[model samples]
Target: MKNTIVVAGATGNLGHSICTELIKAGTHVKAIVRDSSDPLKVDALKKIGVEIIEVTQFKEKELTPICQGASCVVSAVTGLHDVIVNAQLELLHAAIAAGVPRFIPSDFSSEFTNIPEGENRNFDLRKEFGQHLEKSSIKATTIFNGCFADILRYNTPLFNVKGQTVAYYDDKAYWKIDFTTMDDTAAFTAKAALDATTPRYLRIASFRVSPNDLVALSEQYKDKRFKLVDMGSMEGFSAYNKIQRAQDSAGEDELYPKWQQAQYLYSMFLVHHEALDNDRYLDLMWSKVEDNI
Candidate 1:
């Protein structure tokens, strides 16, 4: 049998893209899914010649044999806490037990290690998972590809393209934020998984854009002016941090706290702008912001 690559969370947006790219490259892909997954997605995977396996949980004993003959395992699970911490951890142990050489965790966001704790719960969970991976024997590679470009295009509360408006906490419009389309990120991930010599950490940016860049692109694409609103200064971010800390202590389940944490994250994007690693992968083709716009 050919060496197969197992993909956990294969039904997800990122995982599905990665599986498609791998198949395009003529690699055998085993898509690990749950029984509760959508039937349409499972049928689609089957139609594309992907072997689908259903696992109720990421238990090492059950997954080790399932992962037999697999060369690599790529996880694309997305969520706040449990999915990152519990599910991925179990998957890591399973990979190790199956003697898989390479494992890529679901870390397709901003550089979580660069951000401080208590500011972003999602980043914090990823950071904690990275620490766990470091202590384990599993050889892992983490991909930080900045914000999802699709989010900028469609997630209205985050980027509001249709309204032609952007809300930022900072007063300036000169902070460079990284954005990568899901397809591009998935392609890079698939290539990285196939290459045994790939580095442990990769930072990829499809394109870097600021509020000014967004406004310029919107103007050019829609032939209309965009309105920019500054929510407040860094002081507002500080207040949000304080509130988020309080919410953590109280163990409250309020959406406002998450929104507050998001403000702090926006501030991090402004303060800690990292250089891109897109040029490192010379063969990979990246999407342009103009096309996405």
Candidate 2:
């Protein structure tokens, strides 16, 4: 019998990509999604042979049997309070009850273990989920792939292509940041889900680069000089922290707070660099900054 894998948030960017990769690897995929998800996205997954199970809510009693017979459960749900804290936790319990051996939570960012709490809101939510998972009986695997390379490629504020500018939290160019394209992250995640030997925590980077390196790559690819903006380390972090505080007060329903948190997260990556696990998966093909540019 073939290996069966159940995926949550299957219509999402990273989740959809993971489903595609799993299908390519010949694994049986069961995509658990909300009934109100985009019909077009659902059709796309169905066209590719994915088994879709629509649920109104993520209750453990309803989810456990959906997870039955699956070897692993991969969640790519993106959110802070309700989805990550409540929904994903419910999914973990259901997976455990159904006897799934591995549970991969939606941790596709930098190593939050080293970053102090409250520095980044998104990382903080993931950190909380990590703590919850640690206390559970099911084995877990986390994939840390730094920032999304493809998002930065088109997002000019982060990696300004038209303006030829790169923003940094500090004046000096001493920090090294890791980046992985969504496609690469998804492919690696699919492989990790199927591999029973995968460790509890895994890290991978398509390219590890500094601010100067980013400017060089932009100049080389665009054939022009790129300007660097020093936003000041302490000042940037303080501003982002203020935004986080506002978010905490405003509750999770507001979009602007989450958007502000995203800005802070990109800025935090410049000042805080953590250990990477890029070399662990030798068979995976990583993307390069120049290639993305």
Candidate 3:
């Protein structure tokens, strides 16, 4: 375990990808999972040479031993309050207790650090956990990789390739939104995990495209003219998003509700990672927007 990396949420899409990348680099990885995790996924990780550790609870005493001597512990788990804030807190303390020097929290999204609090619920939870992570004696690194590029295929209004349209608001037709493919994020993360001197925060994006750029890319890839639709002003859009959040109290019970998606979209417009750390990992094969389209 001294030279090995431990990954929480190893069964997740990003987590699995990270493990594969680390294995490719000849890094020993320990995949942490709950006793209730799917066996098939655990088998998949084992097949790839990842050492699996099953735990009943994410408590410090429980996980500290599993984390002992790990060069880094990566948290790829995603969820609401209980998981994001509470679960990660337990894992963080455990990693520290185990003497892990570096920690990579599951803060993989828009660079909400620049954005004020209360804009996004999931981000709010991340910020809450970040405050705790800050006080810990361990060094931490957070990757803010805008939105995942795979969402483009989901036919959202922002980058609807199937509908051949890219929508914008507040005359932000040219505002670039950051996006990183899950594979690319995983690749960089794997590299970072192996390197113990990584800084506190690293920003990455596979491709940053504005609405107009997306339209052009979509048209070229799909062989169809993509339309650019200006939805409204930023002020109006902000008001509308706030209204949706207020009206949809039921969304609080649901993970990734419509309003939460709206908040992500709004954050996309609001924040941009101007200085990216892509150069930090030169061996990485970054993905382009067209590659995903």
Highest-scoring model, lDDT: 3
- Candidate 3: list runs displaced more than 4 Å: none
**Can you rank all candidates by TM-score, best first?**
3, 2, 1
Evaluated against the true structure, the overall lDDT of model 3 is 0.90
- Tens-place lDDT per residue, model 2, 179-203, is 8899999999999999898888888
Residue 57 miss distance in model 1 (angstroms):
2.6
Answer with 1 or 2, whichever has the higher TM-score.
Answer: 2
Look at candidate 3 and give me any clashing residue pairs.
none
lDDT per residue (tens digit) for residues 234-271 in model 3 = 66777787899899899888889998888888888889
Best by TM-score: 3
**Per-candidate TM vs. native?**
0.89, 0.91, 0.97
**Model 2 residue pairs with clashes:** none
lDDT of 2 at 204: 81
Error of 2 at 58 (Å): 0.9
lDDT agreement with native, every candidate: 0.78, 0.82, 0.90
Clash pairs (backbone) in predicted model 1: none
In candidate 1, which residue ranges exceed 4 Å CA deviation? 155-158, 241-273
